[model samples]
Target: MEEKATSATFKKETVQRLMSLHFKDEKTKVSNDALILISELLKLFIMEAAARSAKQAKTEENELVSIDHFEKILPQLLLDF
Candidate 1:
């Protein structure tokens, strides 16, 4: 439980740097609210991907989750998203 909560925060500076890369202005300033929203969305995406991959592995009677499992579910997962 604690681990899940702890993973929610992303590096603010890295996020800001990535955002700047896409924009024309290198001096663009990002608001904390916008950064927070992006962070939450990123966290949600990672969690959902992990859960789906785990489910695929379990259905195959495998305890270990692997890239193959993720690849199998990737198509439908993208559609669902």
Candidate 2:
């Protein structure tokens, strides 16, 4: 079966942004492998938080969230990233 296009695109974009922001910092040394590892490390938290935010937005408010919402939420888990 084919994957849904919209969700696949969204996931791709989200992953790209996550890599760029978290793994591509200029002052830090990270490689492609590290990017993959870090993404994997945080994937569950991101996915869960995204789902929760989506459900909350849907049932509780008229607003929807974008990948940027997750981007903002990620760094705050620690004082430094």
Candidate 3:
């Protein structure tokens, strides 16, 4: 959907801007490989969360994913930490 695409684009831009600011503050050179790896990791996390949300909604009476659902699930996810 157009909204998803727009949100993705915004997230990408926000990450890039944040990374730039982070590097500027640290004043330490970040290799291209490191940046790429971080970006990919973020994307992976976003996708995984989205997939889980969809799966959970489907299994739970076709309900839509909501912030409240995410909040309820997040504590369990942190058990590994």
For residues 1-81, what per-residue lDDT tens digits would candidate 1 score against the true structure?
A: 354455456888878787888998777789999998887877777788999999999999999999999999889878887
Candidate 1: residue 18 Cα off by (Å): 2.5
Model 3 residue 56 distance off true place after TM-score fit, in angstroms: 1.9
Off by over 4 Å in 1: 1-8
Q: Residue 70 of model 3: what lDDT?
A: 62
Candidate 3, residues 1-81, lDDT tens digits: the string is 333432342245556667778564666556666666677777666665666667667777667897665665666555622
lDDT of all the models against the reference?
0.85, 0.55, 0.62
- The segments of candidate 3 whose C-alpha lies over 4 angstroms from its true place after superposition are 1-25, 76-81
Top-lDDT structure, candidate number = 1
Question: lDDT at 21 for candidate 2?
Answer: 79
- Per-candidate TM equals 0.77, 0.33, 0.57
Q: After superposition, how far is residue 69 of candidate 2 from its true place, in Å?
A: 8.9
Q: How many backbone clashes are present in model 3?
A: 0
Query: Which candidate comes out best when scored by TM-score?
Result: 1
